[model samples]
Target chain A: MSHVTDEVKGYIGVETDVGRCWDVVERGAVRRFAQAIMDLDPAFMSEEYAAQTPYGKPVAPPLFPLMQNRLPYDGTDVISERADDPDYDGTGGAGPSSNLPPLPLGNLALLNGGSEVELFRYLHHGEGLSFRHRYADIYERETSKGLMVFVITETDYLDDDGGLVARVKRTTIRR
Target chain B: MRDNDAARADAPADPRHFEDVSLGERLGDLQKGPFTTPHLMRWSAAIENWHKIHYDRDFTQQHDKLPDLLVNGSLKQNFLLQIVKDWATPHGWPWKVSFQFRAMDVVGSTLFVWGAVKRKIPLRDFGLVELELGIRNQEDRQSTPGKATVALPYREGGPVPYPFVPPSADELAAGEARAEGA
Candidate 1:
């Protein structure tokens, strides 16, 4: 690990075109993710079961968006180039590259941090969801491991009623 | 409360007051285990997360230099949600919640999920409860940290009505057309 100056910029914000909103919210994708996660809960699969519940409709498991949404192709293609392009089977890895810019920003060692989300209601298949993403903040701190940079981002999801369905905040750390 | 005693605590001191909660209220902690590549495989297959970073170490190292098979960030978030749901259920508290991704949770790390209430509002239907959340690895380094808002049962009320749902037919069709064009 290398110790260096806090070369971190504050939050940056971006918007997803309305057209891409449905890319991840499809009913088939929702079912696939629900099964993949072993969330064999009946409500996620059965319309009849779901209709009996308070939701009165087939609902995807909570946290469905995290499972459904894919990173945009523009971003994915950029990383694929960096990963040197490898055969995929739904796992993590890019490839060996001595020179890859820092995640989002340039010149930093970024690590996979973690995130937390709250579900206002379980998302259902064929249900349309829209989101606006904003970078919230960045903090510089010292860790025993070394210098660390924390980037926090927030995405707001709205439903047909224009009511906010869920808001997801993600933070990543780079050294 | 003593750690041992808290461990054995059946429920919160008062259930109704759960809605009257404040920022300092400790929501307790939960432990998970044996998260492995197979776990990731199962989840990935189910979700169809074709992204290579989740499964291939060579791909990750060559491209991003990530450590061995990484745990899905969403899995960690699910763990957080499961913990909170488990903690609240004994008291018969069911709520609607919202959260953000704060970090990437890798394999071989032990996570301790905790939170504190940050704000509260009384909606006509339910209590709006907001809290700051944190998921720290065993190293005491916080991996992902963010905020959350939940719709809790009113102290004197029953349950909150569903406030968030998808758009209308016209709206969805328009969204579909826009998406296809894009």
Candidate 2:
């Protein structure tokens, strides 16, 4: 029961146009994110300290780019829309790498397999961010639990000038 | 404004130069938890990740057929980067990190993120330190296992260039050649 049908395999090399986030890096969002992770580094908040650092300004945490693809203000409410659906996993709407067409796996459970990230610089506050992602690879493996499909996606996070901020390769497992 | 004291405590007063680090040296563990649903919820909300398994215990147990409200691999990853970043920042830069979610850490688990210097490669300008890292629970069950590379300045040199310029292929080859010769 190979899930790697020709259609699924066709998604390999599928890439999205560079899309900008709805908002620039905001101080408040960075604060909440830093607090949530319990990483209270002053470089992420204290303007005074950041000025002395090499970055010269307060910056978001290294992995902040991954969360930059937020829903627009006028975006549809998938949570409300799927409130009545029992199987809705609460993950909906276009996200960082969701611009690609959905894989043909029907009713399979999704899990985050892991990721490899190469960080060039931190996202500075007030800086606009853009991303382009591609389906780098897709394959299946037989595990003790069952057969699972692994989807590898590579996303490049860039600053307003299109300078690279971080490059992330994420693996999503479908069972 | 948001507890600057903790931030200052995490910040290294002095720069960590390449010469300061030794192979096989261990970094101080970064601990978080006994993580509860609130922790997972905050992380999910912060990132706007609506994965039900992180918050909806009923769905996680009944539908997903999991043991408990599983912690977000996303959140755990921050812990991984934090340990490396906190260790390398102020003077050095965390260049690359890779990890696999080999196991799961459910709610109520306390996670300790740990890292150790595995190898050090010295280029012409700066050096790269390779580290083996992971997260383990109170029960000593390892969940996330990964490796990282951090760029550090030599003690006699300036800071590791910001917007880190990775060593060119030639520089890497020359550094490896030097290491092999030594």
Candidate 3:
């Protein structure tokens, strides 16, 4: 059974307007992120050291953009809405591409197939951010397990001035 | 917070110059895990990713039909980036990276992130080093296979330009010719 129907393919080229992140880069968040990744770079914490670096301020790690989006205080609560559903995967609400309409595939298992990222600069603390997501492509492949649909989404992470910080292409697999 | 001094000591102290790199040089490995549930939970919370496959064992096995709580491919990417960034930073920049999650490493797996220089292209101001990188379990099962491009300054030159500027078409054509000849 092919999962990539015409409706799914229609999403290609679809894009969302540039959306603001829920919060600006915060020191405590960056610190927790660094600790979770076990990367203790002083650049993420020490203003004294970071001031001498090219960025001229404490900067988050290179991939910190992945965690910038969060559920807004006034947004719908995905957790509370699905509290009674045993199958809730805890994956919805807000994310890099959450603004895009969900794929038509219903109840199919989803996987994070892979990703490609081009980083131009590290995000400095206190900087507000924005992102825009587009569905670049959609196709189906017959895998050993069965037929699977691949959804390719591209997200551009931008600083407040609209300068690009990173471009990420991610693949989502649904079977 | 962990010891920043120790982490700094472990990271490359000086800038890694393009002139100093050899084609086949191997980067020191960065190891993490026997990843526990707390590790997975901490990562999910840090990123606000509530993917149940990473934390709910019953749902993962019964519904997702997996062996155990799987390690986050998202989390593993950080390890790959860390090893590359640690080896190339302070003077260089990790310009681009791509990786595929070919296999699932369940919870309790110890992962070793590794990379090696595979190709080098010299530009007018700096150099680009291409690397083959991946993550391997303790049993040597390769899960994430990828490539990266890192920009490094010349031994006597200034640091690689920040917010890195890609080489121009003319510079790339010239670099390609030089790389082919070398």
Candidate 4:
């Protein structure tokens, strides 16, 4: 396996520049998302049905961008360190600093823990999307097994018209 | 009545009305064989997902250090949609669906897709039903969790149901919480 360090720096504390456009949503793209996710609702495909909605175009399914690669986030709010023991659940009574586990050799190990996404609107078909993200939170906790890193990344999706479509905060557990 | 036999057999019956459904009713479960390279490939082709990790095991091994082919994130989401829409076919569209990717759904694992109605809300013209939904592997590992809201008939006789309005995040979270409790 490639050392975790190589991919760690690329993913951890990484941010996309302002106005960097990601062709995150389009008509074909939305249709594909709808098809991929097995959502057969005609509203996602029928121009007339979607036109009745607020967006006035066939809208992409709510979670489409997440399926795309090259996610962007703001990295200003990250904290990294080696852990003494990495198996601690983040539910410790104290605040982030005290409850954090040790970091290991500045070596990064990360995996998808889970996330919460809030959608305000759908990405209308054929619309260009630009987004930027930020490191919402980062900390470490110790456990009998080893130390692990708890990282939260937040990505904001915007349309070419500059309206917010959705926001997602993904938490990754790195050991 | 004797003359109506041919007409009755030829004409398809109307979809079941939403009024016929009850809370906690199941749509029946769908099971797929253990995941495999071909299954993943078909799903990927259908969705046009080109993520290296999903198809290229070598890349996954070298870059992400993950085991065999990682399932497409969207595929799991698709499975949830399939389970819900199939159950709701009688009612028509349920407007909103939002879910989170919980864990990597790997190959060689059987998945059971299922859902149950939690409650029904009456609207001025139509009714909105909230659903608690999930997809799990054979080992009972939940791969995805989310909520769907469907529009139903206010009374026994109503206009053909239309696509439902998808629920907002708050609504989905509340529904998810309820499902967790169950």
Q: Please give the lDDT score for candidate 1.
A: 0.54
Q: How far is A26's C-alpha from truth in model 1 (Å)?
A: 3.6
Docking class of 3: medium
Listed in order, the DockQ scores are 0.19, 0.65, 0.63, 0.10
lDDT per residue, candidate 2, B1-182, as tens digits? 11122736533468888888888999878889888899899989998889899989899888888898889998889889998988888788999999999998999999988999998888998988899999999999999999999998898887788898888989988887776675
Candidate 4 C-alpha lDDT tens digits along A1-175: 2233544434556565544343545577666556444454555667765554444556565566555433234322112221233322111121111112332334354455655555555555666776666666666667564676677777776766776666677666766
Tens-digit per-residue lDDT, B142-178, candidate 3: 9999999999999887789898887888998898789
Interface RMSD of 3: 2.8
Q: Write the per-residue lDDT of candidate 4 for residues B118-176, one digit (tens) a residue.
A: 77655444555678878788889987777776665544556433323445566666655
- Alpha-carbon deviation at B114 in model 3, angstroms: 0.3
| Candidate 3 off by > 4 Å | B1-5, B10-12
Error of 4 at A110 (Å): 3.5
The pairs that clash in candidate 3 are none
Worst 10 residues of 2 chain B by lDDT: B1-10
Worst 10 residues of 4 chain B by lDDT: B1-10
**Cα miss at B141, model 2 (Å)?**
0.7
Q: Following a full C-alpha superposition, what root-mean-square deviation does model 4 have from the true structure?
A: 11.2
The order by descending lDDT is 2, 3, 4, 1
- Residues B52-136, candidate 1: write the lDDT tens digits: 5667777677766666676766666665565454444323223444444444566666667787766555545455455666778
